[model samples]
Target chain A: MLFKGIAASHGIAIGPAFLLKVEELRHARRTLIDSSESEEEILRFRDAIISVKHDLENIADSMGDVVEGRQILEFLLLLLQDPTIKKEVENKIRCDKVNAEYAVSSTLLDVMDKFNIMKDPYIRERVADVKDVGRRIIEKLTGTEKDALNNLKQPVVLVARDLDPSETAGLKPGQVLAFVTDMGGKTSHTTILARALGIPAVVGLQKITVEIHPQDLIIVDGIHGCVIVNPTEKELSYYAEIREQFQEAESLLQQANPGPALTEDGVRYELAANIELPHEVEMVKSLAADGIGLFRTEFLRLIQEKGENEEDHFDIYNKMALDMLPKPVIIRTYDMGGDKFRTGLNSAREANPFLGYRAVRIGLDRPEEFSIQLRAILRASIHGNIKLMFPMVTHVEQLRSLLDLIKLVKNDLRVKAIPFDENMQVGIMVETPATVIALDLMLPYVDFVSIGTNDLTQYTLAVDRGNPKVAYLYDSFHPAVLRQIDTVVRLCHAQQKWVGVCGSMAANPLAVPLLIGFGVDELSVAPSLIPDVKKMIAVVTTHAAREMAEKSLSIETGLRVRALVHSYVIGKYPEILLDENDWKTGG
Target chain B: MIEKKITVPNKLGIHARPAALIVRAAVEFDCDVWVESPADKVNAKSIMGVMTLAASGGTLITVSAQGDQEETAVETVVEVIRSGFGEEMI
Candidate 1:
């Protein structure tokens, strides 16, 4: 039987289902302890308090390498030791003469009740942490080890109803093959943990835990969100072969060039890596990227000291530029919002964060933080390898203001006697339709343009990528999206400014040809995809790509466009298409 | 009594980190600190009360204090709110 769910972490795992049986919390009745026993009750509560405190501090102190564990644990520890909350719980035990477990659980319920009704997702999500602490404290007092995922006999597909934040911390690397959860969506802590663990996962199957039986044979296809349960031996062998072919092909890709991207036909394209965090630069270097394509420079603003100044920004940018060394690093001025982050004169809260004050919009409206960023980038550009870019360019005014801020920062640096590259190349992302149509108005201000196809497709199709129901409509290969790419590339070339395509479309083997045909000068892909994209560019001639791109415009539907591109790539290399059926249907 | 009304500006509002910071600062003052949102009033030092207020970004909330350090407590707490926990600036 096949079940569908959200494909979270990407991989394949075949294992016996190890159902994470979560035994319900079994606590004693809320009977009043005798007056003589009351002192013991308080003592028990005190001992548990110390135990829970030690537990949280241990987690915080030894945060080892959880990307965002220390700060969160610190916050949880503060919540655990709040004097006001301590007073409330103490009052319940002393005045009511109730058992410690009873008092603690009841007090947490009061907080949980309020959180359940909160409109803010961030506040509401904390309800889990509050309950985690409450449960931990109660377990210590009661000496109960209910539902602990402690030991496993062997590696198995760990399935659960709803994974708590605390439970996931105990997941040993090789003991659990993959994660399959019935609750929580794609961005839940469970999914994040799964991705971090580098395991196959499918979440929000709704009744996966109920349907999956222990020791049952299951194949988790993380790429397609398909879970095959108790498959026949024939079907099992088919998947095994596919997995082998995939790994073999991947190893072959690893042997591709570790140099600049030059097509076999001799056309040069900048194959850069998309880096969201600084740590990812190591992988970019390993993949041998020509440069950093879309450095999400906004993330540097987060998890930072409150009063970090221009020097702080300079430190990070300088390190990145030096690391890449002579390679152009296009640092986007924080395209924040829509699950990224909100900083710099813009609050995260908005009726419509996707469409509202975010990215360059906030920068133009209030230039305080924007000015600082410009100065930092300008100073770093003195290395002569850094290229600055702006996101969310829907208006000519936004681009003008952004350039104006760069002007102001340049003047400030000169006054401070700081030398920088006076002619640093500045660029804007042609993501929104307005920017694409108004290319003539905006190109004069920019030295290069990159297409952020992810957002462009979303806005053009009027589909929210977060809304799974309509997410299928948010295809980057939609004919209209292709037209937008074609227009941006064509317009940029006309003005003698370079254009690059970034995002998933740039890396997709099928979409790579279209982007090249659209006259994109660069393909900024994930570090892992850089080698594969470079190899594809090296093989495909730009002339044929342009011909295929022209024919794709006349295509009516997004499905046909995807098929067209798939067939074009597969016609040359049949192994590129896994199914081998996509090429046949394209005709 | 010292009182001031301020807007919560950080995007995530008074989530976890900001709530903890506010509580930490509140306990340092030798005064009774209270946060009054449009829906409910809560003790500023209590993480639950502060979080339960569910003040999203841009929500106007009032802070009041009464005691020896009332003037400083209210002033400090109000700044934290209006500042969006320093996320609005560098």
Candidate 2:
């Protein structure tokens, strides 16, 4: 059997599936007599609740000062003590004469259903908390729970519906070979934890937990976002050979540590990782990414609260800065609003949200909101290398105001006796054609510019990449977008302002050459793509890349440019680019 | 019952940490405390209830409690929001 999923972490793990079964509380209404049995069942339920409380208390106590762990336990404790739930359960037991477990489960399900109807993801996710505590109570009442994964006899490919943070905390690389989940995105807790732990993982398999039996032989190809189960001898040997070679290549890449990724002409280039979370600093450091090219600060808002406070942002930023000490971390301020407000924050439902107020627009309009982020980044810069970048910047004047706001924030920080890097380099994303046209006027405002080609392509071609009809037209390789990037890079270089690219184009195997040829000082790719991109850069010379760039620019369509550049790359290194199609499918 | 309407000032607006802190505070008083948004009301002492509120920054919520310490309960919660849950969020 074979299954495909979202590639989360990179590597291969061949091991037996260790199913982490979620003990879902099945609510089969148990009939209770209105006399002695009812009273006894209620007593039993009380005992179970007491036991659950004790369990949570123990867990909480064990965690000590671990904030998230303690918070979860505290929530569970509150749930157990919630008067409404207790009243609902008692009412069901008394009025309907149902068993204690049934009453508890049914009442919990009612709340879960209520939460389910909510359109807000934050509210919807609360259903999981209800379910978790419900399951705990049910487990106590029924006494039919599986042992925790910590009891596993050997290292195995952990398969689950979704590994919660607690479950993920228990999994060590020595105990768990890999993680495969039925549901999760690349940034899910399981995936993030796996990446930080250097464990290969594949998520969003949909039903891997249902199909996979305990101890079944499985091959988790994290690089491909697929898993093969109970493979035939031929398939097994083929994969086994690939796995061995992969290990060899991994160590070779690690050993090759060719610092700075210089071309044959000794032109040094910085390769950084585009990180969404601070936890990914581990992967970034291990992969030898020169720094974090793009830190999606929007995730900081999503994971915590909508427009999370400066303290939370500061703590995360400070830790990341210290963790990657001396390695530059370019934090992009909330590139949210428009179609991608995950928290259902309607920044006004405009028909054309893509062109609507977001990013630097939000910053310019809400300086009060933007100042907090600016202050946090500024304060965090004292720890280590931290560069701040604004996103969706289209106008030079707006860029000027945003920079001026940062200056005010710095003055405010000083007045308050807060120490920060007085000269933290601020930059703006060159993704809009307006910025491209105003390149000469824009270069002097900041230290550096990172061309976010993903948006630049969308805005340049006037096509939504998500729209299937015109999605094909959304190409970073398009002559105009490339020329825009080309213009920005040239003008930035001419002005002595270093330019990096943190977009899909940075990691695209074909676009890599053109980006290099265009004299992009830095390439900030997805952390997983770092090694492969490094390998591609190792053999190719600046002269060859420049020639590829010049030729591809002369080409008309993105398709032709892609074909030309990829052919040049393929011709340069035939062995490495193999199975490029079979790699992870999406973001 | 003592009741007062206060704005959620913290940027995250009653997320996990705030919810936990609120729950902790709500339980400290001898009151049947409840928090009401425009649409619905939930027990202030319940973490799940507070989280389910899904109150983002600048949303208004009314705190009501009925007990001997109802006055204190409402005031303490109001203070927590005012204090930005012990952080300089405001």
Candidate 3:
């Protein structure tokens, strides 16, 4: 029987299934106690936990983003604070019945058992979390440590049921060629880590242990999430050709890196990246982005406990604007509704967060906070080309209210003799169906409009992205979604306002041609995906894209639109086409 | 000890939170605190002085302190400006 899973991480390795069975854990625990003797064992156990704490801290320090690392450190700190575990060992010492090592082992078993019995998957996963903490502690105690990957003599493809952030962090790029896991979703830490490391990984292969034999010849395609076992020569040759084509295409994209994203007909389109943090400025520069298309400012508000002040907003925005200098940066003011802002501020628990008081609505409600941000933005504008964009504007009244606030803030600045850009360009993100319908009314008020397809598609289809059952219905290519996008783009263009798209759909190669045809002036995507999307855009003529968009819009079914776009893109640029077998095989 | 007044260059001003970040850095040394703006002058350690400065981002004010760490405190406040008051993304 053949089973396929989403290949999230990339690389191919054929190795015997070294299933990390629960029984090995049982053996290791049993051995831990059997080998220990006397009161000296408690000292050893304490030393072990201490060493693990140090190791965890070191790992956290080495990570690029301290957020996840800090989380793991906090977890370790909690484990050390576990009164039950501490008391058990102390009781053993006082009773003169068992050694410290035995006490520690028994306490660990109790904690692990509790974690395993948790009904919540997240809680149950904590069992591995405990084990990982245990392994680090034990390694420190026993002094029988394996060198950190640099000591590995032979390269191995790591196969795990699943890997946590801590475990994945310890993997060395040289020792691990690739990874395959039996479980993990696309946004799982395993997938993110794999992408960051540029390693190929396949995840969510349920019951892979049964099908994959140890030492089976397996070819893994990380991009398409395919794994081939004992492939025929024909299959190997086919993959080889595909691999060569991909490399050539990659090289071509690299050559185009220093060049502008212009079509064969010489129409240049602005290519920018959407960013969540100030740190991402480096990534945009590396991609040679025109500038930040959308800087989601809410991340700052989320990271801090209190509300963000104007100085904080100004400082960050000013720094980003100055850093990106010359390149125009469009900052979408805090789009903090939905899951993003629920934790703090006036954010209330809403049944439908996407449609609730968010973006400009919330900004308008709290003029003081909004003015602080606006003033900082205004102040930062003097440093570089910075534009302000409000998200989730549904009506002309909302736009007008926001514009009035901007004018008021500008006037206030002028009265204070504070220097600011008098004519800063302001824009709105047309994300809601209401906003799409009222584009003509809004067109005259704003400088430009960016179509946020992610939310737009979700709202159009009335499907929550978080709900797995209905997630498939949230299609960007849906006729309704496309029609809204097209209307907004066309209307904006007619009114001489520039329009762009900053959504997952914008980066999608299949949607690029259609977007171009829809008269999208810019495509803002993840920095890493920019080159590939640019390459796709370079091959297709504006004429072809328009034709494809026209065909796509007339289609009644979302799948048909997707299929048409896929075929249109592949027909024009076969090199950019993802391998079907690789996509299906769960490599 | 030489004392200099510097307004909170940060948009947030010397409020409780940015005040917390500032005071935490201040307590690392031994110094007497005072801050003054056009409107008022008050104890630097006094959260009130920082607040009264009403130093929103880009506001100009003065900072002064005394002790062996006086120069250090004054310089540190000035450094916040050079670094954009910890807002500068490196």
Candidate 4:
């Protein structure tokens, strides 16, 4: 059986399935204890708490600097030490004459209920922590404590409904071949960890947990987001060869220089990284990126319950600017809405969210909130090279109003005697078709423009990329999308403004040549893709790439454009393609 | 008894970490400390009590204390809550 899902992390893994089921704690029901036995019941609960704490401390000691894991353990430890929980449970054991396990479970359930009713989603999520603590205590009391994740005897393909960050953190390297979860998206925590660890992952399978059985043979194709169950002998050999080739390609890419990103014919372009968080700055440095092409600010909003304040934004941008000194860090303002976060003020479901209020629309609608970010970016500008970029600008008026707002913010900073870079370059992302057609008008107000191909493709083709039914229509290589990018790049160049592509297109092996051929000043991709992109750049000549791009634009469809680039690249750099068969089918 | 009014400071409010910090801070003084929100009041020295207050980022709350070091306890507990629990703040 073959199942498809979102290709979260890239690779292939073949192993026996290890189905992770969330087991409910089984503890004795409420039994009236003898009045004389109340003391013993209380003592039992205390002993169980102590044992759970000790076990958690052991896990914490072994977990070195995994932030999410440490937080979980710390929370659990604190909950155990909570005077109210212990007092409440002991009171129940004594006054209600209930058994120790029953008292503990009941008390913890009350706490979980309180958390569940909390208006704040972040607080509500804490019910998981309470449940975890309760399970550990109940298990300790019943002598049923089982460390399922740690007892893995061999490598297996881990399948689950969905993995919490704590569970993913408990994963021992090389013990799990891949992660196939029934829930999660491209930016889910599991996906992020899988990428960081270079493990194959396929998420949002919806029914994989129900379909998969323990010890069943499974093949996880992270590259194509496919899972093959109980594969035939011929299929096994086929994947084995592909997996070997993938590993070979990865090692080869790793050996390549991080880069000057110069084409064979002497065209130099900056190769940068698009990072979502501050920690990824380290990865960006290791890759020796020219700079950060896109520093997504949405993650901060998503993490912080009340949305990030100016100080939070300033601290991050300041540190990032200081760290990547001399290299530019283009921080894109929070691109919220549209499958991302909905503003606290207006979270009502939009019929067409992608086409509705989002990004710059939210910024303009809430100037007070938008200015907080603008203030932080301007303040951080003095620390290091930091550039501000706005997302989803569809018209000259939006650009004009945004520029006007910036001027007001700058004046406000001046009045307050705050030190900021007066000359900080401000730019906007050209992702809308309206912006692409009106590039000449918008160019005069901005310092530079970065073509965001992902949204551009979605908007240009009128396809919601996240909707499975229309996802097939979402392709950045489409001639219509390609023509808009070419036009934007040409307009930016004609006006002597810098231009770069920061979307997935920048990292795609097939799209790299066409972008380079379009004379993109920079290519900012995920840090892991930098080496691979640089290798591709070294093998392609500007003269030939330009010819390919020209031919690609004249092509009628995205498939042919892709085919044109694919054949051109394979002929020039055959090693870059995983294999002829995989490339031919557009894997 | 001494009482002081303050707002929850952290962006995430009194979640587990902040509640733990508040409880840790409250247990230091030789006095009874209690925090009262619009909905409920809880023992400042109890992590569960502090968390159950469910005081979101901007919710105003009152911290009151009695017994030895009453003034200092109220001030310290109120200060901790006001400090945004050392979380990311302006």
Q: Write the per-residue lDDT of candidate 1 for residues A1-587, one digit (tens) a residue.
A: 88988776556788898665332232332445476666677777888888898998898778787847876786677778776678777788778877677677778788787788888788888888888888788768645322334556678887877555435544556878788877655444465556545577887687777677667898888767778889999979987887677667666777767677886689887788877567668878877888898887655665355844788889999899999988889999866665455444555478887788778876776688678888889999989999999988888877777777888888888999999999899998877888888898888888999888878887888877655455545667778889989888888888999998876678667778878887888888767667677877876888988898999999987678767777666677765533222222220
Candidate number with the higher TM-score (1 or 2):
1
Cα lDDT of all candidates, in order?
A: 0.76, 0.78, 0.66, 0.81
- Give the Cα-based TM-score of candidate 3 against the true structure: 0.58
Error of 3 at A546 (Å): 1.5
The segments of candidate 1 whose C-alpha lies over 4 angstroms from its true place after superposition are A1-3, A6-10, A13-220, A227-248, A342-348, A577-587, B1-90
Candidate 2 Cα misplacement greater than 4 A, ranges: A4-10, A14-218, A223-225, A229-241, A277-289, A302-312, A315-327, A337-341, A344-358, A361-366, A382-384, A458-475, A582-587, B1-90
Interface RMSD of each: 1.6, 2.2, 18.4, 1.4
TM-score of 4: 0.62
lDDT of 3 by residue, A329-436 (tens): 998887766645554555457877767767777888888878888888999998649999999888788888888998899999889998887778999997778888
Write the number of the candidate with greater DockQ, choosing between 2 and 3. Answer: 2
Predicted complex 2: CAPRI docking category? acceptable
Q: What does DockQ give for each predicted structure?
A: 0.41, 0.26, 0.01, 0.43
Q: Which stretches of candidate 3 lie over 4 Å from their true place?
A: A1-222, A226-252, A302-307, A346-349, A577-587, B1-90
Chain B TM-score, candidate 4? Answer: 0.92
lDDT of 2 by residue, B1-90 (tens): 999999888776777678878888888988789988887799998776887787878899999999888899999988887788865465
Q: Give lDDT tens digits, candidate 4, residues A430-522.
A: 888999998899898989999988778878888766554555566777788899888988999999999999877786788888998888898
lDDT of candidate 2 over A454-520, digit per residue (tens): 7788789887754434444566777898889889888998899999998767766677777888999
Binned by DockQ into CAPRI classes (incorrect, acceptable, medium, high), candidate 4 is acceptable
